[model samples]
Target: MKLIKLDAIDSTNDFLKGLSVTQELENFTVVSAENQTKGRGQMGAVWNTEASKNLIMSVFVKDFVLNPNGIYQLNIATALAIIQVLKTFNIKDLSIKWPNDIMSANFKLGGILIENTFKSGGRISSVIGIGLNVNQTNFDNLPKASSMAVVADTVFDKEKILVLIVERLKANLALINTNSQGLWNEYLSILFKKGVPMPFKVKEKSFMGIITSVSAAGKLVVSLEDNSFVEFEVKEVQMLY
Candidate 1:
């Protein structure tokens, strides 16, 4: 794997996207930065982090899954990879909030954002940007934010954690082509709030529901009141705490 270390940038995903278009890059090529001025999250949300205190990186992956319908496999495989890495480091109570927010006991520990590039020949490549709080200790006003240092009571080597996560991603993504169902099952087992009653909001309505399972297309499947079931795409519904 080729690694590029930058002092800082606007967004690692944007940098990787620029590189992928400007020149040929090998699969598993990585770009890491010490800070980001315009870090992004799912659905255009801003990713806020303390400078040089977290793992900010993007990875280029190619020739994995060509089927557009199977894109959610990338998310499942990626989430499991990070969860597994944290497990090895003795980070406890890890769970994935719907889609791909990494959580530990209700606190946000990391996140994953994947952007894909498509070619007319049915080939696809992805730039996966991962942000994990490593040594940062102060969250200030971010109530749900926490870090490995706070959760595990020790400082961490951010580079080593990045290497482990990338290695696991490579292995997990390789299995997705044939063992997607297996991966999906594994993802569901650790899914946050599964089988528990929770409140949700849709457009202008509010209701209580239970998160049952995720659809193959990555929609959150909820069992609502009155014995009804509904599926919601990401950002279509908000889970109210």
Candidate 2:
């Protein structure tokens, strides 16, 4: 549970990744910063947060999942942990949008970016970066963005939320270390728009599809209007909603 606090950084993920390479890092070593200049979201999307108003952090964990195929479990565990912690604040309509965006009542609350390093002999180390809007309410340019303060109408202590998230993450991650079957089911249960027809874009083309299960490899599975199923990588598809 070693935690590093920084006033600012280019990217917490990059910092933790470099730290792991240079020296020994404890399991679940966490690095948090008040601001990030080059923060990144899924698929290189820019992650921006007001200084000291959000959670900008990255966690380093090694050998969490035994096999490369099971690595998606890390994403599931991390997302579920955040969802559970936010629920305590009574945030409404909470759901996990596929690939890593956290949603609340159709608005974006946070996101996740996971980077995995595969070592020799089938070992894997992952750097998980999470960005959550805590007390920040200014989203003038970003239409879909909202924060805990705006949504709940109550300012929250960011440290309170961070502590609970870390605590829940450890517990949730430990479950997958044994068997992840139930974890996948729980992830889908609250998955945003699961089984509902929704619009998506692939290669600049748009179509309607029902969100189905997620592949073991972490690809989004969709059932198209033709009743045919297809798997899409993170870069290949875009959710219109």
TM-score of each: 0.98, 0.97
TM-score of 2: 0.97
For model 1, residues 40-131, the per-residue Cα lDDT tens digits are 99999899989999999999998898799998899999999999999999999999999899999889998999999888899999999999
Collision pairs in model 1: none
lDDT of each: 0.94, 0.91
Error of 2 at 200 (Å): 1.7
lDDT (Cα, tens digit) per residue for candidate 2, span 136-212: 98999999999988999999988778888889889888998675888899899888888999899988799999999
**Model 1 clash number:** 0
Q: State the local distance difference test value for candidate 2.
A: 0.91
Best by TM-score: 1
